[model samples]
Target: MSSSNEKRALSPDPAVAAPVGEVAVSVVEAPVAKKAKIEDDGKTGEEVQTETQEVKIDARDARDHGIARVKAEFRVPKSDYTVTDTVPSRDNDDESELNGREDTSRRQKRERGQNKNRKFGKAHDVIRLCEAIKDGGVCSHGDQCKYEHDLSKYIASKPEDLSGTCPVYEAIGYCPAGVKCRWMYSHWSKESNKSLVDEAKKAAAGREMNRIDRSEQLLLQRKKFPTPKSDLILPYLESVKEDNIARNGGNGGVPMTNEERADNAATYIEAPIKPGEKKRLNYSHAKILSPLTTVGNLPFRRLCREFGANVTYSEMALALPLLQGTKPEWALPRTHTDEIGGFGVQIAAPKPWQAIKATEALVEYCEVSAGGLSEINLNCGCPIDLVYRSGAGSALLDAQTKMLRMLKGMNAVSGEVPITVKLRMGTRDKTPIAKKLVQRLVREGDVAAITLHGRSRQQRYTRLADWQYISETAQIARDTFHEVEDKNKDGPERAPVWFIGNGDCYSWKDWWDAVDNYNVDSVMIARGALIKPWIFEEIDAKQYLDKTATERLEMIKRFAHLGLEHWGSDEYGINNCRRFLCEFLSFSCRYVPVGILETLPPRLQDRPEKWKGRNELETLLGSGDYRDWIKISEMVLGPCHENFEFQPKHKSNAYEQG
Candidate 1:
């Protein structure tokens, strides 16, 4: 009974017919005026027809009409849309429906944090060779050793040698990994089954510095390592604190008894060395690299050094672990020959005693090394929840007196190795306290240098760093230094404290601008260097170098090469290198090609819309996909082992399911 217009409305429109492979069919009844037919009684009648027609709705149109249509080629089935939740799978062919495609949708549930519980599988070798046996020494455990001792059996089951010269052997003239090296074919002699070594070259190679011997580590673990200076300084600091409290009318305003005064006087001891006597450092206009965690391993620091970073700090180490002589924590201070003159060790501690003991131990162990410690930096700026919750890192911002006490004790114990501190603007985003702290640091801290990151603990890389505030604090420090210098004119002259500013420094201009206009001695780069390792080179040249994709790949190859040299060429070492390499790539991928950018001097916060690169290699280098980073790693380190798995520390890189 429907009219012609109604039937036409229900029918598919030819103008908006669906494209190929996207048609939908529907059945409908319509009155079709068939030729008037004569019935048995000779009466004329019209016929009603039922027909099925393809709906022919465009996929785009269907989406507009609240229908989900996912393309086959753009599917990402295993995508993790939120930090804690995986994307739900679709039951039908519409599996490619983009999960959290809208910016708001993506941001609604996304949590900003690091990847948790990442799986880094152990060595692929079922029978790991014993180090003693591999070094041609008898195992301490003899026949009951858990590790494989038979060299022939290990070699028989070893994976095929990687196709390249052993980088470590080439650099140092000896392969420490020996039979276990993935590139063993390059350094091993099949005829004699002996590893080849260039004795002359080996003899000339400079040894890696800051290494603690096993006996020394054991001494520390047994609490037998001597900390004579810390032992004296800790009690002196405690007595000074108590005297200050008593002078301030604490303890019910009770005056010190003669016995108490005598006890305090006996405990008091002067520092063996003074701040004026410490080894002086010149940080003025230096291109420094920040002490990054996770990504700032030894190999990465070496890479940045090659790119012209003048000063580099070790990754932030925990003071308690260092005091305990844990191998992993002790390993952070190990330095390459190239890092000697400009290297610093950064550590975090919750209390003065811990910081003092840790500083004493590091100075005692590492001070005699070639070109000894440039400075020992106390890390008070780290904003991670783990460090903050432990009353360390940025937690010190809320407890200024405790931080100052710790720094003072650290200075007392750290012989000629001068102490420094890295700090944030404040614990909170709105209220900054560094300017006031600068005055106290000049008067009381006796720190050799100060580096202030312009962001607060609460901000946590969410906003642009307040350089104006950093500049204000730097001026305060400068003024305070002058005041201290005037007061100490008749006393032993101390070296001026260097002030370095850090944050959002991504280019040559950023570096020079802070030094020229912001009143900072220098700027320390973190994510900037990770994004472009050659940023220091740019600062020197004062111009941007549009590196070709091949050149970038060469840099990656150099990183892998250096990684193998530092980490070794064993299976475990290769995987370790791969994991860190991927971590580097996760940050590196944020870089947009200068050629593709519509403007000059790319901003670090500017996230470019999806765009193609000039070449496939360039595109791959700029891929957000972690798998592509793995592919890039394979290009340098050879095929990934079957057991190798990598999850990027950042959640942004997990968008691609693979």
Candidate 2:
């Protein structure tokens, strides 16, 4: 038989039955609730009681203990606990439990190293300029040089039948790849062992390909990019020196007095660009795409452009790496010829010096008219753990003073290029500080635009973004900008700083609602753009698009073609396209068929249950498995690498079962 103490131990709350001094331990279990039916009265909707069922307690020894005696005398009332059976249906209950709660611990770790494929063989093992037949110079190493000295030997080694024309040779006139390229036979002549017989010679005559002309190589060679007439470097350095003196003495190395501090402030020089001369970018009513970290490659942005995205941003590049002239980081700023007019390069920096120098280098290398860079945006909203740990990304939200300094320095050095900032609600959840931050940015940041993502760092993607707060903060931005305009009336005329809101804009309806209600200049989309690349088209039509599986497949094929063009049609480029395609599929597969949804304008957070598509193609397109995504990629780009392993960034409905 069980004692009273044993019965009390099962209760969720010990205060209900335990004496003042008695201690009780509770067993945690999934709560069960009695169902309630709603019977709408003609006058009012009300819940009418139908019948009461006996509570089923899973007490193992209830019969032996005669639980009826304990229940009759000292029953734990049902009123003590709130009912949780308000779930409308079992499907909804299941969806609510799974939505935004996916586990991605394994996938996150493997995400960084997945793009490790590189072409084999030494790229530099070719005939040098000094040894070239045209140069008419002999190699100092002679036979000891690793590269082929005889032009005849190099031509004889090439395959008799050529595959295709060398893309690099076709572009720049000379083939830097030289003997290493598989398609060397097509570019090189069968009769002549020289670099080219006709086409290559003509192209080479037009322009010479210098193998040592890489961006990083120039940095290592101590070459500086051209400086603007209105250089800010001197003023910035002087300001830093004055600040150091004010805080920690001038010649004596002691703290200065209040009068000395005032004198320093009075003597400080400002590096402000003349208002009429500063560059401007039009973001108003612009269909802008958010800068995706990995998936937002050049080909993908070009695809978005064709679909209707007007203003596009490059994937975020780190400032330190850009300053060091890293190859991969510099590649981030390279845009396709088609995107030249509307592209903006986004950069991440933790310090003012890093930001200013990186911006200056970018401006010099990629001019507004030539390099496709319309604006420079500072990324302050990245939430990845690595970025935050480096005192960059969302970590800047806590370091507002430093963020302002970085922005101002970047603006001063950018020269004819506008500066922008992307921010989040705040660092922590339920503690929104973007409203106040916007006011400060308007007053001192000198930014051309500000983008506020509606979610905090703590929220990640767990909950739906708070658009209401976004609208409120947007109003604050509008008022603050006006206030700044009034204060600057006596000074140089300034352009209106655009305020763009980003988050959870999945459908045309959501986009319209946000723009109409929030009063923001425009909206920037991230996941929604991936899920449905044609979202901009829908926004124009003001309706939901039900793109068929065949249409979607065609879009994927276009993406592959563009990838081949940008990355190359070679084996390495094909594999690179396949990898990025799979990363894109990680978000694309989450899209539920608009035809199957019972509700209009599907929500981003809604997790659909297991369901089959109308056809095999649709089923495959809607698949959440990374393997299925690979199969889809294979349909367009041939077989995958045997060693290639893919894990989706997020666990989708199909992977949930695993």
Candidate 3:
């Protein structure tokens, strides 16, 4: 919104707020919400009808107040009641039976119209609350909302819903739909026109809401998971012309040139893992949710070796494929001896049987010290609708019954590997029942830990994460678990399990801030590392260090070789390997150029393209042979290929629709 517009809205009497700027007219009608939002295919959001609303403002009042207040409004046209769909409309001159009923219907329709208009005009409070709830929708980062307006659709769909209360209000202390709340449109709108000006008395203060930290003696009889968190080298040689201009002043005294502007716009990402920590994780009551998505197919065991990541999880593996034992994709990648020795394999199961049967064979593969893994991670966090509708991923959040069934079955066989579930905020907006669900999972389901993804399934990855709510949930976890501990003092220290945070981790600074700011155990990464592989190394080094073109090429070469070694040497396999390796290179190679790059230890971002390959990439880039990448994947995953064909299992963005 424009500053002037905001100023007008703050007018003492919003009705008098001013309208500014040229108004935009839309011909497309508002969409109506389909009752059945999801079907066999997938979830297609609601559809609403739209009718034009011509709002007229009093020029004098608006100019004084400085903002515009909605005057008149339009509604998306309602479906016509006709003879074919329902009964014949009174428009038909059918005499006898229909005559009297037509008049009655007319009266009812008039009354409904009056109620709707009155409701829309007064729709503010509940609508604001609904707005808050929608605003609270998860962003890639946490839930400290800085936005003023989010989730406009829910509000825009309903013309009169803005005035009243709804279920969302009761659950979240506010509504998100604004004036469009269901209650607002329902015929129960209320408005208070007069107040006694505080009875001529002064206003008084009130107590603030208190947030108590309650992590004492908790035992929610649940399982837990381990959570964990780097940079870039440039490929080009220094750009001397740009460098000189940046150092001196620019032409016409512009702060930056077009070239500089282009460079500034390029996207960058940080590493996923925080390295150089003081100790290894205590996995006694912890499960590792891995192989993390930092560096593609980068093994958990290797991460443990490099950064003391005591526990590691396999990337989410499909239960059906893994159970079939023919899974070659990384989404359902297998765990090696080293990783299994440290942590239990995480399984993404849509049904209870998948969780049930997989646990049986999975346990045999794990060889932990006698008792085995600390916990088995149930992948309830996947947002992919493919898994959700079947009671897997975040979809599990909506189906409490199915979730309980899956957890119960998994718990039955969890001799050494306790069953734990990871869930997002809920299936959609206003579903704060995650706390309630967590309670159920602990009490009836008997799971171990509840790692809450601070987003709702509705969010996918669009909005900011709600950290405040995560902390609130954490406090709830502590309170619930602690009470259980007090009741059952003999049960091991009533450990409150652990609360893990995810999303928007771009740098060590972000990781430290989250830990210090939110008291989370660990965080998971996916896209952040896709653009920067050296983040872990940077964390361990403790200081910012830029890598030169030559240094980065070496890392690239090493990664290529690792890929080749892991996949093997066949032409087709190696080419596929090279393409994937190049994709990684394309992103990771983008470091800050010149002046910015020079801020660190080495100077490389400014370097020219000729400086790209350490030895020379002219041969490698055009050759299309990735003997180098396979070698790198091999070093990371270990040897493979009898027919000289490279095969890698770990993968993401798997739809590959084309």
Top candidate on TM-score is 1
Those runs of model 3 whose alpha carbons end farther than 4 Å from true positions after fitting are: 1-310, 329-333, 337-341, 368-374, 490-496, 539-542, 570-573, 586-658
In candidate 2, stretches whose alpha carbon ends up further than 4 angstroms from where it belongs are 1-216, 220-272, 641-647, 650-658
Candidate 2 displacement at residue 360 in angstroms: 1.0
- Score every model by TM-score: 0.82, 0.70, 0.46
Residues 117-188 of candidate 1 have per-residue lDDT tens digits of 677755668678888755345679988888898888998898888887998899889888888899888988
Full-model lDDT, candidate 1: 0.78
lDDT of 2 by residue, 503-556 (tens): 999887788888888878899988899988988877875545556677788889
Count of steric clashes across candidates, in order: 1, 0, 103
lDDT of 1 at 266: 79
* lDDT computed for candidate 3: 0.43
List residue ranges in candidate 1 displaced over 4 A. Answer: 1-113, 135-141, 249-267, 367-369, 654-658
The candidate that achieves the highest lDDT relative to the unseen native structure: 1
Alpha carbon deviation, residue 42, candidate 3 (Å): 46
lDDT of 2 at 33: 30
Question: Considering summed lDDT, which 10 consecutive residues are worst modelled in model 1?
Answer: 2-11
